[model samples]
Target: MAQKRSIFEEVGTNEVSKPAPQGGLIEKGRKGARKGIRAWLVVIFALVMTMIAVGGLTRLTDSGLSITEWKPVTGAVPPMNEAAWVAEFEKYQQIPEYVLQNEGMSLSEFKSIYWWEWGHRQLGRVIGLVWALGYAGFALARKVPTGWHKRLLFIGVLGGLQGAIGWWMVSSGLVGERLDVASYRLATHLGLAFVILGFIAWYVFLLGRSEAELLQARRNKDAKLFSMSTGMLHFAFLQILLGALVAGIDAGRGYTDWPLMGGQVLPPDPFYIEPLWRNFFENPALVQFIHRVAGYLLFAFGVVTWLKGRKSANKATAGAFNLMGALLFFQVVLGIVTVLHGAPLALGLAHQLGAVALFVAISRARFLSQFPKSQSVREGL
Candidate 1:
């Protein structure tokens, strides 16, 4: 055997262990945690999607304003006794919605709407608690890899902001000449929820693709793929915003037919309401028409995106593209069904959930396309 060497003795330069590149330690730990966190994020994202769907139900049922106050802490427990329930109902009776729209509403009637709003608020509270606890546990346990801690914290902040915006939305309805929330404020609140959902979906996709560089390390192919995928996501977001506008104005109540709205491609009077721009946000017919048109356009774009992506050799790119195509098809079908059914509660809620799923698909595709697998890196490994 060779002579025993001292701990610090130079074993020949070539025999010495090489230090890993810059992000090596972080990357090493990242691989193990990536799958776990990706799964967690996906589950959390699904929960958020469900929350949004429930919110859509609340809005569709006109139950969102039933709760007259926002007591963030106490509100979570709900009204537990008859006296408490009466107090809550009495407060709602003073609101414009009750005075102008639901006058003579009985206690039982009040409870119907109150339960929906209460459930909505309760869901929000639970989501906040879950996010805080999960994020704190992950951070303290060092379960999340390096770059993701900041992002997880940011998501928590957005969730808090969502709570504030939800109250802001409610306050809009509680005061002023109108008994309903301002359409713009409603749109803004819903839009922000979608934004948060999109971020979570995209981040989860990125985590899943962390070990793959089949696209990013390759300049030309990857850049074009990323561009196309990102464009799809942008269109998805735009369509969701348009959907929110439709929901805000109660647009689904009109044009109860498929393929045509009152026998015209465009409503007979698109901007018959107030200022011309107001039609886009206030006129139910026009809002519904625009939403329908946007759906068609989004479907077309999604199909085109899928077709283009199919030309790529990357499996993730191809898979994501196919998923998007399927989701868009399902969404279009659901939209038509919802319309034909006169926007029945169940169908409308399903359509809303479909939209969220489609958005997630588009976001996932974009993320994966942006970070495809790399052959060079694979060979080295």
Candidate 2:
């Protein structure tokens, strides 16, 4: 027999021995700590940005080949004394970069470049360690959101691949007659870096909001704006790769004039390298010329994209595109200044950082388009 409710109790509800309420978090609450994961990703993002800057410095200073070996673990401990320094310097001398380019360089001079390359490699190690530890800890604690374990793990895998790619890029310069890494390889390495950065950045954005919020926002997405912003992101990445080619062969330093490469509509002797196809990578003028043309076209497309993006019914989406447009315009000016100044250390690094900034901006705009916030009628108006 069950206990029955009184007539007075019937006014509020029927209580015929109803079940007790469930305790603990429901399924939604069990989704894990999104905010904590987002903060960790932000830290990685900053480190990678710093890595790019250090890499640019290494290239500008011609210090990339100073290490001459890829000892992933042992190399972390740099030269400890004079004898070890001499031994390392001796190894560097064997490479064409030192033999043909820096012959008779003093130990002190070698040490300078060695430190830069060493620091770059060390930073890479730190990034890997951070990612590994973060993922492992989160995973072991069962705090990673369901369905996201693989995504977070995929980033670590890419980081490992990046290490291999970094070694591949460095190895090219250690061979016969090559004063630097293969231009294509350098571009590949940098292209992958941006790819990794893109993943991390997108994840950060996604994590900034709750899963429910993102799902609801997705319903309000501006499909056209998303498509346009995706295109813009790809174009910016292409420009970044082109910039890498220019850096690989020091092409930026070769043509110090902007708008016109040395006062010509086109860079002189664009086909100086034989085999026709070889000119695209080995020819300084051709690489820089292509890079310059690409920048102008990217800017033009960005303008068209911006005009469309600013009309979004969602203010947040519009603001993202607006921010992207501003960065795009400023980046163009920065490139010209970088070229006019012969791609010196400070300007060269600044230009690369500018690219990173612009890349993030475009990414943010794309994210907003895909997950636009809903607005009230008054705000929409």
Candidate 3:
């Protein structure tokens, strides 16, 4: 028999050749400047938070109905002269809010609220412009990630929808005997804002790491913790919508008592409104009561979620949950303080910011659950 060549031996030139090494993670490398994209997203996120704060202040100041018109393009130029200001003020005088509430409000007083609403709309325009320029620049440069084009596009779509919804909300207060926008419409506007904020936050989290790394990390995901955090997120969103309802009718100011409404477990005339459904949105007592109960339930659920997150093997995830829990506690306390103080501008804004912080905390915790970072035993145990 002929001698058999060992596998390592170069038996002959005719031996089968190995194919060139196929691309490995080439797609991931081509994902564009993820860090750069993340920074851009962070900027947008901050602006959205600012928008929310400004919107809250506008509502609190009762400045939302001051504009009396939705001149998206031309309104950018505020009244520059006495004649212009007088013309704008005349339009405002025709609104039900002015007729019923501020029957003989002076021109100077009208200017105070006019500036607030104008600034709010102007900020919206700025946000739109920033998004457009950034998106166009990245897209033209071919720097946007392969799959992120649509994701980025969605933010602008929501922004446009939010504008329309804003107009719809304001239109409700301009006519009829109504002094404010429909509570549900206000809820819808605020809810959409949160949704937009949530998406930007999630996209930000995803962009923090490479696609390949994310895929690998996802394999070891703590499904249970993720599920719990998701529930917390949904509950928090519900609470936010309830808050909008409260603000819509000044329910927060209606009940300045804590742990009780009108000195009882529930308001006495909770259902005084003719239509039972109307009570939930119109009756200050019922709306505030629902908001208080929901707050308690949300805090309880958040505690349970935090406990579950603490048991995670990943140290970073545990820390994130810790932060989330702390913020949740702080928010609960702030809510009480806001109620006790009758939701004054300072306390109300603080409480709103607290909600924002808690929302972000829970979001980060939930994301960490799905894509945990590396944790060595030598690291904080």
Say which candidate scores most in TM-score: 2
Please report the TM-score between candidate 2 and the true structure: 0.94
Clashing pairs in 2: none
**Candidate 2 local lDDT, 1-381, one digit each (tens):** 987767666564543776788754454665687888999999999999999999989988999999888899999999999999999999998999887989989999999999999999999999999998998889888899877888898889888999999999999999889999999999998899899999999999988887777888998888899999999999999999999999999999898876788789888899978799999999999999999999999999999999999988888889999999999999999999989988889989989999999999999999999998767899998
Point out where model 3 deviates above 4 Å.
1-25
lDDT of each: 0.81, 0.91, 0.91
In terms of lDDT, the poorest run of 10 residues in model 1 is 211-220
Worst 10-residue lDDT window for candidate 2 reads 7-16
TM-score of 1: 0.87
Model 1 residue 242 CA deviation in Å: 1.3
Per residue, candidate 1 scores C-alpha lDDT tens digits across 1-381 of 887778998668557677776755545766547777777777778778878988998998899999878899987787889998899899998888998999999999999988888888888888888788787777777788767888888888998999999999889899866768887888888888898898888777677565434234445356776787788888878888888877876788788877889987777888898778888888889888888888888888778888988776777667877988898899999889888878888887888888888887887677666665554545433
The residue-level lDDT of candidate 1 at 18 comes to 75
Candidate 1 residue-wise lDDT at 158:
93
Q: What is the overall TM-score of model 3 with all chains considered together?
A: 0.93
Task: Give the RMSD in angstroms, all C-alphas superposed, for model 1.
Answer: 5.1
